[model samples]
Target: MVTLEQSQPKAGERAYAQLLDEIQSGALPAGTVLAEMEQAARLHVSRTPLREALRRLVADGLVVQQSPRVTVVAPIDAHDIRALFEMRRALEESAARIAAERGDAARFAALADELTAARLDGETGRDAYYDLISRFDVELDRAVANDYIASALRTVRAHLVRVRRMARDRPERLTASVAEHLLIARALAARDGDLAAHATHVHLHNALASILANLENEGSA
Candidate 1:
């Protein structure tokens, strides 16, 4: 038997997060039909909250409801994915610059906390490393706190997560990722917009190059 304790984020939010995670992890994949009844049964939740959650995803451009009938995952392609992550780099770098100017100590401290955990992971992790990276990325969004930029960042992050498991697993790649993120953090601390923005561009460029290289290699082999 299990005890029912009321929780934070309410039921809709909880379901939304779980479903979002599933989609991001590639379990749900783009273009998969998501029947409401089936999802409610699978998630062990009522249809109302699940529907609400789906609506949220739809608005976020992660899902789409068809005319008079079915709901399916949104179609995403390599070009779209590239554009989204590139937008993230641009938006987040600008935010980091602003966050530093605003003197948001708590935000920086929060990032430090997450980085400390990533450092403890010591390189690769099937689970912990990603968890750490996710936290750091979200906080980077928070540190900015502009509504428009934040909205775009959130959307981009969610979309990118769909491919992140593939992007992040390379050991050599992961090592460099940590170092670049560290540079961004250091720049933010010093309130250097130019440095923060430049470092972020370099970081994203490197990540894009790595992902492209791996993908190209996969195609050849």
Candidate 2:
């Protein structure tokens, strides 16, 4: 739900952010052509800033240049989802282990309590829950204190927004994810690196399975 503000400074950045949000949210779905003039007008930016934004999206693998004049949103499929999860499993498991060993225990403890009490009944509740998860990710990144890992994670997370949206309708999976995250948080609070890593592994495993299943169901339908 990122709004495009015409008055924002750094017009390229503003255009990029708005376009990225639209692509990730499926507002601009796969194969949607991004005509320079059309997008420039819609986003209230000039051609130069629009091109800059498109170039950035291309670099992020969220858009593809169909031709010199045509850029379209990239298609995501089951194989792509699996590849994304492979990277997530590696980076997140390592991050959880490192965070458990060196992160602030009280902070994770508080996060675990919040996860325990999280409500996911409605859209607002789900938004709040996701916001809490974002907080947890921030804390985990801070605890690891590794610029390289954090940078890699930032890239992985950009694509993950679309993956998460795909599963938004699955309340069961969402509920399970909260429990899985709670386990990892508690392990971190206890300073149990091995347990935290194992929990992360399990969580990723379950998530990949659920997402693949949903994808298959969609294809059949």
Give the poorly placed runs of model 2, Cα more than 4 Å off.
Answer: 1-9
Alpha-carbon local distance difference test for all models: 0.74, 0.94
TM-score per model over all chains? 0.80, 0.95
Candidate 1 wrongly placed segments (more than 4 Å): 1-9, 104-126, 138-142, 219-221
Instruction: Report the C-alpha displacement of residue 135, candidate 1, in angstroms.
Output: 4.1
List the lowest-lDDT window of 10 residues for candidate 1: 1-10
Compose the digit string of candidate 2's lDDT tens values, residues 31-135: 999999999999989888788889999999999999999899999999999999999999999999999988999999999999999999899999999999999
